[model samples]
Target: MLPVMAETLSQLVADSFEIAWDYLEATGELGNPDIAANHLLDTIEAMIRCGERRRLLLSNNAITAYQRFRAEQPLSLAS
Candidate 1:
C-alpha cells in the first residue's frame, strides 16, 4: 500500500466537476460538443498527471519513512 497523502480541497472540487462533466457528456446534455470535447481531453490529461505525481510522492515518502525507521533501530535482536 502507498503512504497516506493529503489532497487539497481544490482537488476535491475539481474531481467533482470532472465527474459532472463526464456525466453530462455521456447523457448527450453537454452543449458545444467540439469545445467540451477539447476541454474534457485536457482535463483528463491533467487528472492523469496529477494522479501520477501523487503516487510518486507517496512512494517516496514511504521509502523515506522506512529508511528512517531502519536507521533508528539498534543492531541487536532480543528474544
Candidate 2:
C-alpha cells in the first residue's frame, strides 16, 4: 500500500511538471540548459511534499514559481 501510494504521488509530480513545462515551452518562456525545467520539477515536488495532490493546481503553482524565479534571476534564460 505504501509503495502504491508513493508511485501515485510520483506520477502526480511528473504530470504536473510536464504540464507546466509544456506550457512554458509553448509560450517560449522556457529557457535553455534545462534550468527552467529543473525549477518546475523542483517546485512541483515541493508542492507535493506540502500535500498538494491535484495535477492542475500543482502545475499552476509550479508555473507561477518558475515565473517568479525568472523575474529574480533573469540570467537563468538562454542568451
Candidate 3:
C-alpha cells in the first residue's frame, strides 16, 4: 500500500472531491479542468521520475493508469 499524505492510496479516491475543492480555493482561479491540479500533475510525474532515478519501478498498474489519464487529456504549456 502506498502511503501518501498520511493516508493509503485507496483513501485518495475517496478524498478526491475534497482535494479538488481545496485546490480550487487555493488557486484563486476556477474552471472546468481544475487547471491548478493539472499543473500539479508534474508533482506526480516528478515522483515517478525520482523513483526511476532510484531504480524503482512505478508499478505497471500505476504506469498504465497514469498513461490513460494523460492520454485522456494531455497537458501542454499555456504559453
Q: Which candidate leads the pack in lDDT?
A: 2
lDDT of 3 at 11: 46
Q: Order of all candidates by TM-score, from best down to worst?
A: 2, 1, 3
Q: Give stretches of model 1 more than 4 Å off.
A: 1-3, 32-79
Candidate 2 lDDT, 1-79, residue by residue in tens: 4545444877888888889988988988787637887888888888888888889999998888888878777473542
lDDT of 2 at 56: 97
- Local distance difference test, each candidate: 0.47, 0.81, 0.40
Q: Give the distance in Å from residue 2's predicted Cα in candidate 2 to where it truly belongs.
A: 21
Q: How high is the lDDT of residue 15 in model 3?
A: 47
Q: What is candidate 1's TM-score against the reference?
A: 0.34
Query: What does candidate 1's lDDT look like per residue over 17-63, in tens digits?
Result: 45545565575545454544444545444655566435334333333
Error of 1 at 27 (Å): 0.8
lDDT of 2 at 46: 85
Q: Model 3, stretches more than 4 Å misplaced?
A: 1-33, 52-79
Q: What TM-score does structure 3 among the candidates reach? A: 0.26
The candidate, 1 or 3, that scores higher on lDDT is: 1
Task: Report the lDDT of model 3 for residue 36.
Answer: 39
